[model samples]
Target: MTFYTYGYLTTHHNTWQYARIGLLIALLVVFIGLFVHYLRNRWNVKYKDLSIITGVLLLLVLGLQINSLVSLQSATKQSGEISATVQQAAKHLKVSPSSLSINSTSVSDNLLIKSSQGYYRLDYNTDGSAFILEKVTLENPKIKLVKE
Candidate 1:
């Protein structure tokens, strides 16, 4: 992962998630501390039972958080791959990203990039699990603006 990917993950990519994670962490600490205080001040069977319940809840929340992180990581990885591919294509063609354009909507996830130098095709699986760049020839490429 590049620094750009990390930046997007922290800043641009579903910013609400990071905030939610932070809030959950704070609540977890506060509630756990409260439970510990109760247990320390007075020994009770009910408090111990509730503490066990809290432990189970903690595990569940952690599992869910891991699931959320996995989804976020996958989405970010895909976006990063696309961005890197476009940037690489631009560099290979000796042009800046602003001078480059790509079209992918009709290509089933693969990209057809256009630049003044030539054409470059970024081929990848439809599932976005992989991508590769290749020099291509297109007579009349109807590429729209997608210079990531």
Candidate 2:
């Protein structure tokens, strides 16, 4: 998870945003109730001490909630960027590109490349150009493209 964060942004594993919120609210309610009970039952305990504890707990909870929200938002934004880049690559590869004979690369087994249109391998070396295509063999064996 940390490695992925360092490179590609992934969505938070917790898809249950509502559940997380509910759990946090429940914990806050329980903590407050317990603190109140402790204060009411313990005459020796100072109210000032309880107030301090409550303030600290509230701060901690708020910090946690904010962090979770920020992390979730960041993951979403990064994932969107990655997806957009992949789509752009696909679009460019589908555009007119020079094709050659079948290659030995693993990506060649499932796709066929043509100068104008064909299934394109995602791992082609495009040299940062608009797109690149490599020859691939399909199961049907009927795939054919004329070299331009």
Candidate 3:
């Protein structure tokens, strides 16, 4: 809810918006309630083997989900930590927010912002610091900007 609210307050750039994770959490809560009831002998179970298989599968799915979620959250947090850096870079470059574009570098702790001048790679290691690098983008490689 807070994430959604924050997105609403800021920009809705994330298309997924993590709705799948929310749905998975709701399903997990319901499953846990039913499983608890079954364990307490309050729920009727006609297919014990099927239930066991389903529980195991759910656990596997949950484990995979946890792993992915942790990685994604860390990446998101790392990028998020440099939001102010991006804004300041934009102001320094005299670029408007609409024209400024920000991206993250997985290879390093850097937040990259592309502008007409070049790329501004912000490095905030608990210190006020940033740097820029120039790159000549060719229009012939439009696909490169989109995807590989």
Candidate 4:
């Protein structure tokens, strides 16, 4: 899946971020409480089992936090790359990037930009390190590309 889709899956907005962190903290508190109770009732078999379960849960929460951090980093990087590419393409077309609307599919590496001048599609390389103009459909016949 693309970074955009993955990010959406994990978090939709700032509120979700706060909510997720809050939930994680609550889980940590619960685990700590369970562990302390287990220690106070060390002789009970049930407390021993509960303590082990709490330990496992703590590990799971730690893993989830790590994964969330990685995902956020990746999403930020991918967003920057996409913005840069769009700006470069807009410059080439002699238009403001803000004037163009982007349309991308989750399964496709290509991105489509629609502007008043025409429709342009950009296709990325297999490794996604670079992209090139794949196609253009101009709205005006008077507009022409100058050969350099």
lDDT of all predictions: 0.61, 0.47, 0.52, 0.62
Model 3, range 25-46, lDDT digits (tens) per residue? 7666766766776777744684
lDDT of candidate 1 over 1-148, digit per residue (tens) = 0112222322345666777687668657856876886778676666666666766777777777788899888777766555666566667667676565555312345456666776666777668655676788867544434212
Give the candidates in order of lDDT, highest first. Answer: 4, 1, 3, 2
Per-candidate Cα RMSD to the true structure, in Å, reads 7.1, 11.6, 7.5, 8.8
Give candidate 3's whole-model lDDT: 0.52
Per-residue lDDT of model 2, residues 71-132, tens digit only: 87776765555434344544555531122222111122232332234344545344533334
Task: State every prediction's TM-score relative to the real structure.
Answer: 0.53, 0.41, 0.53, 0.59
Alpha-carbon deviation at 79 in model 1, angstroms: 2.7
State model 1's lDDT: 0.61
Clashing pairs in 3: none
Q: Rank the candidates by TM-score, best first.
A: 4, 1, 3, 2
- Compose the digit string of candidate 4's lDDT tens values, residues 41-105: 87776867776777787788778777887877776666556666666777888887666555531
Weakest ten-residue segment in model 1 by summed lDDT: 1-10
Candidate number achieving the greatest lDDT relative to the actual structure: 4
